[model samples]
Target: MSESKQDIMRFPPSKITDVAKALSGDLRVRILEALGDTQLSVTQLAEALGVAQPTVSINIQILEQAGLVVTAQGSNREKLCSVSCRSILLELPSRPGDGLHKTEEIRMPIGMYSLCSVQPPCGMANRDGLIIGSTDDPRAFYMPERTDAALLWFSGAGYVEYRFPNPMPPGVSIDELRLRAELCSEAPSFRMDYPSDITVFVNDLPIGTWTSPGDFGDRKGKLTPDRWTSGTEYGVLTEWSVRADGSYVNGARAAATTLERLSLKYNQPIRLRFEIREDADNRRGINLFGSAFGDHPQDIVLSFIRFKEHQEGKES
Candidate 1:
């Protein structure tokens, strides 16, 4: 794929130090995270970060010097700053005694999912926490602007899938693969004891299942808008990993599947499917958390681990 179209950004090892230094400050990192896609004036950034404008300006200068941020004169000659990249990633080989190999991670916004097969009570909201189409309507999922969804939920068994492009070099076999998301059961009412059997599939291969405890509306989600109080709030951040031994959820063995059995192709798209099987012991439904409305500020994430020397690293 062309550099302009690449999903994950890769940098040669020569850039490790500079990038690391630029990202070393917590305030600068927060600034980048808050910038998202739209340009934010320095004052807006300060307000969002709860910091003074001068503090934000100082950090923005550092980011500008490192080429990670760009500034433009806005209305009234005010300076607006924005991150230059959608995401930044770095791969590192595992140190001795660590249980893994080299790893690369990517965060896929919930709305960027490539496909879906959902049922009613299914709807999505944008970053502002406004419903995109209509509540309890399946047609909402088909809207062209669904990519703006910051939170999605449904009431029955089905799946939402994402197709991640494979960027590894030829012959680089993965030792382990992990998918993490903040999710829970979806209910019309906040049912604390409700259980949903949520399953994850990689490239159509079943990895494992996680039983979400409930819809969890006991408290407002850390990032959820104040206006969203009656609906499900936050979800549990869960991780499903397919290792050399077997599939694991939250560090416990959950399935008998193995890494090699996944048959992850080196040059083909990797499809991730999250479903609540029709015959599942518990079909409480599913609620997928997104960066803007979840207690955990992230969408679905995928991590690739290579036990041996990664050819792609050298190529970068």
Candidate 2:
């Protein structure tokens, strides 16, 4: 057991049953162990656990609710997860506090590279639709400037969206909130010349779709090994909000977040999604690109990064 911020908060070992319950699941326990010294995403964690990404997400949810783990939004809206490294304090149940609410600060992976394949009819173009590329060849990939490229695509199964972490220093009131993303497609037209109306979702709520204009890139892109050569033209500057309970593109309050958005507790998990309904887009296809850009020796796409504190909050 550990000491508390005040003499009042103490948690006896008997009360640790909740913590024990939180740690009871084999997968949950493994997550804590695997996170011993690092942070990982649902995709990475799934790969490490040898299971589907959603499986790991479900387990992470359990751990988060139990206060055993915490999560943040990573590049591409993926969940970045890490264990809560806090000391436990045994306090009297009759007192003001019980168990341990103290938590460690969590670090996350930074964005580096991304790619995506949009359906047909979406008109895959560059930053301007003037140079609409051709995606007739499914084996092609775009060679946009490494510094400003992020892949965007549509899926009937839908894509997971991640929200960046906004730290609230001590006691600051957070009223209005914003969610934004830079997106583009692979094919010139989504499908049969249909437009791929992509939408964003945070915590299972709809935000909106590609609304800006044109596509990404300037013209025929540079060639890269193991990538598609013929690309399409179409792109957008997507944005969402919780304000109006609606989705929008570019600079609009597609949706709005009240206290619920800012109510997120430290060392807890959050969920985001990029959803495309079946028969909603042009081609009904998924495209992707594998890339990383930087002079640094690390993976171009940000790997999961984590941080742990030996002491709880500052009062330990």
**Candidate number with greatest lDDT:** 1
TM-score of 1: 0.70
Tell me each candidate's TM-score.
Answer: 0.70, 0.36
lDDT of 2 by residue, 123-209 (tens): 222222222244332222243332232233333333434443434332322332344344443334332233445565555555555
Best by TM-score: 1
Model 2 Cα displacement at 221 (Å)? 6.2
How well does model 1 score by local distance difference test? 0.82
Regions of model 2 farther than 4 Å from truth: 1-157, 163-166, 169-171, 186-194, 211-228, 232-234, 243-248, 256-263, 279-316
After superposition on all C-alphas, the RMSD of every candidate to the true structure, in Å, is 11.2, 15.6
Q: Candidate 1, 137: how far from true, in Å?
A: 0.9
What lDDT does each candidate get?
A: 0.82, 0.44
lDDT of 2 at 300: 14
Model 2 lowest lDDT segment of ten: 293-302
